[model samples]
Target: MTNSKLLEQFRSFYFRNFPDDMETQINYFSIFGGLGWDVDTSKPLTQLIEELILQNFDTLNEKIEQLTLNEPNNKRLLSALAVGDRKIFSAFKRAGLNNGNGGGALNYLQEKGIVQIEYSRESEANKISKHRISHKVLFTYPFIRFWFYFIYPHIREIKEKNYNKLFKSIQNKQNSYTSLVFEELSEVLLNYNLRDAQIISSGSYWDANMEIDILTVTDKMEIYVAECKWTNHRVNKSELHKLEEKCLKLGIKPFQIILFSKRGFSNELKSMQSKDLALYSSDNFEALLKNALNSTLIKSFIN
Candidate 1:
């Protein structure tokens, strides 16, 4: 579940001595993981960001600017990818870079260990599809991504302490903004929930046209496709239908189509659940924190 060393480090550090429940920690971690201080997870993120992030903007900005070596090209690419869909073409378009430049910039970012690429899975049933799906560029750390998306582009407002626009944007778009992190953590939770099977490969899947939020393969050749809904509304049958449609278009018969909703499923959707149709809510995400570090446990060992 902690797929990369950086992520493992983050989890260990973020959850070290001060601990909260899974949902509480995840909400704070998505926006403020890299901070040195232990965030008050009980407080709403809006208040915390205003008090912590906006107040300390200059210090945080300087550190990240140094990461890019004060290069406009790198900054532009990162901020673009941070706010945009993160597909290669979308990143270039957002950054206004030509293909050659975009490729060079991407290479530079990757070399610096700031971002990682996830290539689309095989889509065609029989042969390679002519359509070339672009790989997604993801930030190595959640905090960097958070900064680029929320702070980098709006430096003027932030510097002056004009938070009206920043707060407005966060209020309106925070759910969508947090979905990517939520989706990533949900994948980890799934693996934690299902430990018996040997996972061959696991990630989001995409083709020329459609995308599935999660696609996992097991050593036994079982396929699991899933949709993650991080919205206020409870999921319904239509959402499941959409996921099934994506699997059908990709010409793969999944062993099960899973649904992970932040809000619980609708009564209609709940009635439809079975072995082939699985469902989970944020409560299920506690699985991701199995064997979490405990300061008391460590003290006992040391003693």
Candidate 2:
């Protein structure tokens, strides 16, 4: 499919599945003056949210505070009292911390049992801490996160009645925005094809020293290092060389290398498509998603 067509389908799916997020984003932004957290109107929003975050902690001495003090029963109130709510993350991002406040809020939620965190068996290079909202707050938290980070900023355009341009911008950059989701999806899909591939453990990993998108460790200790590219371009050999050198410097691997692209592989790398080196394209990915999401042919596909 053409990139534009692909993006349209994805956006349709996202909106369909996440209608609440759309509503929340619109509502929040409208209330806070177009999601511009730096604006004067947002000052109250930030101060109020920081106070909420502070309520979750007990005077910095580490004593557990009264969890019931805020609303005592309302999930929304509890979320408001916690540190990593949409408001706080917005404040942090506006202050130039980027995703820092969002990350901190998520961590806080995990600590409060309002959400749960899990670690996968995927290799150290790719094993990421997967999070799920506790059943009580599942529908609410993700929508809140999506609102403040994804949809809120676009509020300005919507207010100015520039929806066509807003939608176009979202359409053009959708893949890059959702790249992390696709990377995780790719790892889950690859497991079925790796039966004879000596994979001891595989998962999404990220840390200070190493920042691999995906890492698969073979039983024989060979490491498969991957770089997932969501852009519309062929995967070239230089990227492979870069990944190979990175793995070598980390003191691991008679490396198995794979370059996964949303488009396809470059001509220079096509000749090397073998067991040891591999390239996967967007068409292949669509098939994987179809097989998993359509008929349940792949029972192990992670949603």
Candidate 3:
């Protein structure tokens, strides 16, 4: 088969293996072409991930090492980039890099498409004005996010070909690391399904004292604010109340409030659901993807 066709088959196999989870899809693809027809599923998922990382260590390291060679301070910048929260230029300065050096590294990464720059305005009115533009750096791909989060920091051990400590570190922090991926998936669901509204902008929103997980604004000035919980337990009414409190504090009366949970919702939240409130679980995500697949736009384009 041709290269593109072979890649399509791989994507088909990957989705079949990890249909419901974005993080697992990313894990599988990061070790590209490792999964085959005789794939073993009996082992722990983390073990599988570790094995794949070890198997691809040389390839991954080659790319990273080339980057380091090009820019001597790239590894230091990668260490700073591994952080969970959004960062500005000043944050990198605090991380011990000088302003000019940090800015240059950031520009280089953006140019290379390894990182994306998100400019946040205080309000829609200020979008044209450059006074309050804030920059937030985000990874362009989940594999890069995973690498930076789990593997990049342990470059010394990786260089020594010692993976035991790295595996243990990943095991300890995998859930926390994948939570961001789950939130991004939730944002995708919101973007695809928010029926009447035209999404003008969407992303994680943060001010000095508050952070909103999934925030979207429609062209009609409607706001859809959401929280994504990637936990085993059901999300209760208290979490909804907490969202309300945050909205109140931020002076936002969202047109719709959405809650995306991994396990499901509590009995209280189930009873409280209404036109303005929405609760979604994995099944909803499945339905959303199914609908997208069967959408007229997709079908017509494919034909």
Candidate 4:
């Protein structure tokens, strides 16, 4: 239901049914996973969208209309949140709302479990000012985000049985859009691997100046700082250095610096792996395919 544990559950369900290579599974899951539906990954996502969504337009509209109380403002806000950065201020800005009205609409959505606000916490020991650290507004499910991002934006075009705009937006934006899903699943993978660790907390870390994709701390005070590079190029020493610089500024002496990429690491970084450094490519995600391992994930990690 809620994304509190939604990413992990969708991933589990996907691997169970799709039975594809890691790359194919992740690519399709980014667009279609969060609705608890059985997706036919053989079809292109655009075809699937036409078959499942465009043909079923009135049905979806009825469903969302019920959820949003038929308010255009709420729909506008949801579309903006999905298409843009998850920053709270940016969502309101893109939706063209002042705080009072926008804040009320956000509260209503939060109450309905459609979205939630997550604040960036400053390290108590840091000297940096905390005021500029931004909060994010995230959808409760990936499918809802996908709908708003691709379908909701062009409902009028879709109404005329035209799909050109929808298809174009997806083709152009898919990689960047799916990058967020990859990052989410990367966190899920981390939590699964560290199932035995006494993890105190885990998620994205941000301050005024920088955002770190994956940061996990254990009860032993061990910190793992990671970057998920969902790109085509192999990761190198330079990526590692960037993470190091951010940690240095935050005074975070991590137990390990982890890097995950779609493409594997360079020979230089590969040789540099040690107790304090780790590199992961999508191939490493094959670990998530084990039913025995994931069945106990939330139970082990959550209170």
Q: Please tell me which predicted candidate would have the highest TM-score against the true structure.
A: 1
Give the better candidate number (1 or 3) by lDDT.
1
- State each model's CA lDDT, in order: 0.76, 0.44, 0.64, 0.78
Candidate 1: tens digits of C-alpha lDDT, residues 1-303 = 325443453465456524466556666767775455557777788888977777777777777777787888888999999999889988898899978988888899899778999876654563355665678987877778888898887878888888888788788888888789878877776776567999888988766566788888899999988888889889999998888878778778999889988888999999988899999887776555456655121111001
Instruction: Using TM-score as the measure, name the better of candidate 1 and candidate 3.
Output: 1
Best of the candidates, lDDT:
4
lDDT of each residue in 162-275, candidate 3, tens digit only: 878878887687656666656766776787676556778888886545678888988898988999887768999999999999999878899999998878898889988887
Write the number of the candidate with greater TM-score, choosing between 3 and 4.
4
Off by over 4 Å in 1: 5-10, 13-21, 123-130, 295-303
Ranking by lDDT: 4, 1, 3, 2
Q: What is the C-alpha RMSD of each candidate to the true structure, in Å?
A: 4.3, 14.0, 6.7, 4.3
lDDT string for model 2 (1-303, tens) is 012222223333333333233222222222222111222222343343333222322331121123222321222323332223223333343334435444554456556544433233334444346632211122112223333333344545544544565456545655554454345445644654565666676755434344566777767777776787766567788888888877776666736677777667788899988888878765554433233233211111011
Candidates ranked by TM-score: 1, 4, 3, 2
Candidate 2 TM-score versus the reference: 0.51
Positional deviation of residue 137's Cα in model 4 after best superposition, in angstroms? 2.0
lDDT of 4 by residue, 140-259 (tens): 667778888888988889889888988999989888887887887788788777888888788888767788998989899999889998877888999999999999987789999899
